[model samples]
Target: MPMSSKTMNMLEGLVKDSSFKWLLGKQSSFDEEIEEMGRSPSAGTNWIPELSPVANVVVRRCSKILGVSANDLRDSFKQEASESLKQPSLFARNFLEYCCFRALSLSVGVTGHLADKKFRRLTFDMMVVWEVPAVASQALLSVEEDATVSLEAFSRIAPAVPIIADVIICENLFGMLTSSTGGRLQFSVYDKYLCGLERAIKKMRTQSESSLLSGVRPKKEKILEIDGTVTTQPVLEHVGMSTWPGRLILTDHSLYFEALKVVSYDKPKRYDLSEDLKQIVKPELTGPWGTRLFDKAVSYKSISLTSGDGVPGA
Candidate 1:
């Protein structure tokens, strides 16, 4: 649905007033921070406090429409509905104008169901992506987590709605997955970098008795970049969790397993996205918004376990 100026204004007021800061503590304050930034030195400005007005608008509208009210909208809705239903010939006027509260409740359900069907294809498209992109690219947006916020917004509006999402992906894009060997090797590489052996060994490798290479890929090693391959990846049937559109709208561990396979690693029963580098690699994974779904992948050097990141997940 198209947004109304009134709705935007309402959100602007909330942004200006520090509303909904708890949902995204720092993120919710972006408007104020930007306003303050405009008056200060430009260097090292805080960005968490400066979200795009468009994102704020989107969040505001979604929250309202999905019933994730940060204000008195719900009571207002009930009052307005009650007052309006008392009018003459409302039910006979048609579905929208139907008088009974039950009718209105059912209408919300039907509307949500209808919307799920309309966007079901895109949901499937996003779900097909096996892993989050190293970064978002046109071919494979790094789990394409944007769908999570939007879908969560949808659920807020229609809590009963099912939002089916498949793991989305293509060839040219997939997240980095280091093997146990890779981890072991990075330590060797880092140790070399820390000392004088890195450059010495490189020179030696080029002009030595044997034409062999040793050590590991850097934690910052780039994944596929040359080929612009865009194709569908096979889907996994299930995981520890069942298919709950509303739940997957927040996070899908099944897809994470598929992504683990993308890096040729097995999915840990639990994963952690915030762990620091273990043997060599640092921990970091895409959030659902970027993955186009809800799920935050966390990892550490020796292990990974997925847990609550405050954005619903298995």
Candidate 2:
């Protein structure tokens, strides 16, 4: 179901609040305090009230947005008592992550909402919170403060792009994130990627309507990855004793390799990845004349293709 207008207004108000902004910026943790509550004599004591003032407000707001009781949301943070006692700080941090992840997942379903400045900033703040969920004695600093996120955090909140183009695999996502932000994803870089991905999908859709490959690509096929740059890194296809430099493209259903000619690319040869061909893909070495001198290639063998034929290694 779509989020109600009232809920959107509530979220906007929450984000605009000075205290909430301070909470996100500071990332204060009350883990030690919460842990002390766990040791109270009263059994089943409500621990939500013991959270830091801003955190308490955030949790209550999230509960309201999720249409659940505040206690219900608190109970969702399940951990063995022994474990929580041993690593209370870690447990507290993880609980914060859980709440933010659930809330953001619901709010970011619409791509158009991502264009909203408040929504964008809120999403980035969530990423910042994930990095350091609690107050620390010693601060952890990056090139950009509260601006970088790990791959795991990015995957949790990133809007699904398969609706636009192809299913994003972890390997491809990692490559894009690392290439742009040098292993830690920055908000600006991430936002740019989302905008570029939307434009690329639209452009590809228009091109596919009249392109020669329209007859070749199967119905519902979405391009996953394409590498053909000669200036940076050229893709090379190894077949038996001959090595052919080419452009390689992977889709949901198949792999296409178009060998590079003098100035133009040869007709793309399809390698079916979705077929029941008992395909095997693994890392292998490649060099000149079938010499395995460099461990920088992947070998692909299927019932249809000869064992000597290998996919592009770049």
Candidate 3:
């Protein structure tokens, strides 16, 4: 269902009142599109580190910069990360995909919202093929609605484009103070009824052709299997962290949002969190049931309509 025009207009007004003019200055395409949408534009751009293949080069460089043996670097990275996030090669590759995507999208003037749209489109395409249910944990299984389908529903359908979001939150005070911080990351799989950064990846992937991501939630469940028989495995992990390099994986959106706010606005405490610089945020995945539900709610809202541009989601 399309959001009422009035609601959208109101949102646009909010963006205008507290304008990020700097973001606008950096994103001409973004600005024009918003204008086209009959909305106002912010100036400042939300600058996130680009996830690119070159990052593989960068990680290698980081390894060199840290002055550690190559083998040691890989081992330490894995040792510090969640067992759920142990695939160094895949994590590097996906990070690179994220890098390449922003670079490519930047070339086309699709910064935040536009790029976010691309992510969703790609996620949807993956769902059609993978046949992964739109739900993740038992909480997502529809209760009021029940249905019986045949084995044809179990036909060996193709897999989703091995896409997953491992949302992590950095800035664990205790870890930073004690020089022990790492991501307690959560991974979520997106399908039709399910939605998330996958929506953004789905769109971006269509335009870029990179596999986005897929998978689950807490109690340290690293193994995911449908029907409790066959299963897929966790492959990615935080690759490296030390005293100065700390990490925290977050599955919670509100906390993630708060972290983003604190990092961006609370400058006095920036150094306090700097110990968290080596962090990876699976924000889309990190948090309580409420946070996870918010993520699901976003997906639920996203499925109700087809957006041509922008984060244009519900």
Candidate 4:
């Protein structure tokens, strides 16, 4: 349903008070159009023309860059800038950012956003410069001047060229070329930079692997009888001087003490706490429930074992 007169008035008032107030600066295209509308009332019932000068320019440039029609570009921009009623400046910024992206799309001949690219490419301070070796420069110049490089592939390869400069820079061929290129090698210094990057990545991978292996500690097997079905469960074992940090298992046949360690190459040393010598020092202990539910509560346990009698040493 169309907006009622009262609702329309309220919306118009909101737009006039918020965005329109900011848009009507000292002198603008809108003001000029308003003056023109007053001068020529018979020109059209609408005050603004079908195509404003600014819109026309944006449409033509953006369409040409994207290989689309001016009409299509205008329609797309209008659809994207629908938020103009709420915040006109926000719509303006969106249009400008889109135009900037379109310019990049034109240069690379790829019509897509940064998220579409396979490799990472970031513009710092809106400036991207690379000093290539004479050989690399010659290789770049050999390509057809009209050809455009894919932005997706350019990060791994070369921008506006087919050469894989990143991979080439890591090769011994680059070192040989640099040595022969005289003092120009200093200006064309990419090998050492790439080598440093390679070393950093290798070191990161090594540390990651070390951390992963370090967490793989020794595990002890326990036989469980659940619903008359026997199942073997692997319980993670630890090794440390303090027994407070590790798990203390008490079975009908035996009492076991497993030490916790940061890294374990062999089976964890078990100190036998004799079942006969075991006693419930504290009958029951209280703690917070693991599930943290109001209905449930966790149990704390304390068991002391006499080591002087016949307890097997670790």
By TM-score, the candidates rank as 2, 4, 1, 3
Per-residue error (Å), model 4, residue 38? 34
Query: Any residue pairs clashing in model 2, and if so which?
Result: 29-135
For candidate 2, the 10 contiguous residues with the lowest summed lDDT are 137-146
Candidate 1 whole-model C-alpha lDDT, 0 to 1: 0.27
Which digits, one per residue and each the tens of the lDDT, describe model 4 over residues 164-209? 1444443343354355544122312333433444454444434321
For each of the candidates, the C-alpha root-mean-square deviation to the true structure, in angstroms, is 24.2, 11.4, 27.7, 24.7
Badly placed stretches (over 4 Å) of model 4 are: 1-73, 85-91, 99-208, 211-314
TM-score of 4: 0.19
Q: Give candidate 2's total backbone clashes.
A: 1
For candidate 3, the C-alpha RMSD (Å) to the true structure equals 27.7
lDDT string for model 3 (1-314, tens) is: 24456535534553463245435453222233333333322111111112121122223333333454333544555566565454543444333233333333333343443235444433232222122221122122111111121222212111112232211211232122223213211112222323543364454344311011111233332212111011132111111120111111222221111111222211110111123333332333212322322341111112222343112101
Model 3 segments more than 4 A misplaced: 1-110, 113-119, 131-164, 167-314
The TM-score values for the models, in the order shown, are: 0.16, 0.45, 0.16, 0.19
Better of 1 and 2 by lDDT: 2
Q: Taking the tens digit of each residue's C-alpha lDDT, what string does model 1 give over 1-314?
A: 23345534534454454434435554422344323433333212111111233232222333334454312332344466665543433311211111112222443354333233323322222222211211122222112222222232222222222221112321111111113332211223222222342343344334311011112222342221111112132222222233211111001211122222343323223232334423222324333243424233322233232343222232
Clashing pairs in 4: 238-259, 238-260, 239-259, 239-260, 239-261, 240-260
lDDT of 2 by residue, 18-107 (tens): 344355664223322223223433212222433332343345445555777545765665642345533666654566656665776676
Ranking by lDDT: 2, 4, 1, 3
- Alpha-carbon lDDT, every model: 0.27, 0.56, 0.27, 0.32
